[model samples]
Target: MLQRVRLAVFLFVLGGFLPSVQADEVWEFVDADGVVHIGNAAPPASRGLVWLSQTPSARGGSGSAKGKEREVSALRLPGYEAAKPHLEAAALSQSLEPALVIAVAAAESAFNVEAVSRKGALGLMQVMPATAERYGVAGRILPDGKHAAMEPKVNAQIGSRYLADLLRMFDGDKELALAAYNAGEGAVLRYGRRIPPYPETQQYVDRVMRFYRALIR
Candidate 1:
């Protein structure tokens, strides 16, 4: 039972790290006692039971080697391809650069749509519920009856709008905007319209800038 619980927690916590193509095909195995175990990969006891195709190109396969090449090339970052359209749309909607939005998302959640921070931040850009609400994007209820921020498009839209607003509030200062995103605009204001001295917020600004530079390059 403990093992099953651990496996469940592991999958729940790290589910976003899995490739989007294979994220949906979960496998399950029943022990001799009928206790079920689940994972992204099949257990040895359930040999030969395939939940997903072995080929990477199965989803994007077009019967040509070039098609396979396209799929491979698309995975420049773990979830970059899957999230690109949404990121672009969100950035455009807010008059923000897609690279800046994508950088913030990558730094916040590593492009994990299912990510939830310890502080109740949610989704790809880790938009807090209050922030999302402030941006007029309310939390969505999943089929499981729980509120979710896992929709890439919605979360990106909210996050990008928030970031853009922060940039405006800080007079187009990317560093101050990014610091506000991490530590709150109120904190930035409290700190004299500058990046706060909080170590975590400072690190977050540095990380997002690094990603932004790499992406724009």
Candidate 2:
């Protein structure tokens, strides 16, 4: 039972209830055997399932619903708040939307400042070393005299500028820009400035666009 409770808490923190916002309602109950359940509808009362709590839809039809929407937004991205300051700064400096930057970071590394990709991409935005150098984010003499791609602020700045340039290159077409960001500019151009047909790049663009729409909403 304790383990189930812990799992429930973990799911809650991970936005398990995000889809529930579109449902009419949600119920939390525990059966006589101490099994917990959460869903849009409660189980049979004859099963001795005691209702623990209920929440209305998060559609913002009322004051309470609006508050729930706010809560959902706050919980939408787990590590986003920690990277918000740098994201905002980078976005403003690049004349980009902060939500777009956040979406890229989320899709790249889930806002993990220390994340490194298998292809040598690094930090929240997963800027490649060469790309970092192109954006003047490399060759920093840290206390340890290491490159600064691992630094959150530096990575965000470089990645944001890279994205802005992609946007400009693609004539402000976000889908094409995201495709170039995921694949490569050559691939995008080879596809006639359209999104490449690569499955991974397609999926990455979809995920980042979804995150961007959610954040902007």
Candidate 3:
């Protein structure tokens, strides 16, 4: 009951800041005492934290499912358990929070190793073949003739590396980095490093942010 109350309060506070005039960053930290702390920025020397940033316009998006049901659905997603260790290892390699990587997987492909988007994004993180090639992760040509990014380990590694590169490119702004992930880094750069006004990109960032928050919470 107490946890629920706190989450409600957090949501209320979150909604309150969604209309701020400037891009806003929300930081979350859990101290050794296990209490969750949330603020616009992390205090000096903080540890065990995760955060997401976005322009106000990205709030209340619909690129993915909403509510507690989304979290429950993620846990029940096919291939979730199978992909967990790989996601963890990949995140560690990139010095990212495991929850963030897993959230991207959940938002992208629902942990479906066989999932492929119409745009040709593949595997757990929906990594494009071109993106995977940059990391030397060549998908196998399956017997059914699908270009299959079938290896969970390789796919996760490539996705994490790409996400890490975007994070660096966007100066650690998770929202803009995510926007790059969906709409291409070139598009983000064209938009002056802000979350592009594209609805799809905005919603994708919002969706991933929701999942990351739920996982960390």
- Tell me the whole-model lDDT of each prediction, alpha carbons only: 0.63, 0.64, 0.66
What would the per-residue lDDT of candidate 3 be over residues 122-189, giving only the tens digit for each residue? Answer: 77787888887788757667687766555788889989999999999989999988888888899899
Model 1, residue 154: distance off in Å is 0.4
What CA root-mean-square deviation does each model show from the true structure? 11.9, 11.0, 14.4
Candidate 1 lDDT score at position 99? 84
Provide the global lDDT of candidate 2 against the true structure. Answer: 0.64
**Candidate 1 lDDT for residue 13:** 23
Each prediction's total of clashing residue pairs, residues at least 3 apart in sequence or on different chains, is 0, 0, 0
lDDT of 2 by residue, 24-133 (tens): 34333332222234454422332312222124343444335454354335324545688989998999999999989887876666566766554667777888888988
lDDT accuracy of residue 126 in candidate 3 = 79
Q: Candidate 2 versus the native: TM-score?
A: 0.66
**Residue range with the least summed lDDT across 10 consecutive positions in model 1:** 1-10
Flag regions of model 3 displaced more than 4 Å: 1-73, 139-148
lDDT score, candidate 1, position 213: 57
Mark the regions of model 1 whose C-alpha exceeds 4 Å error after superposition.
1-75, 146-148
Q: How many backbone clashes does candidate 1 have?
A: 0
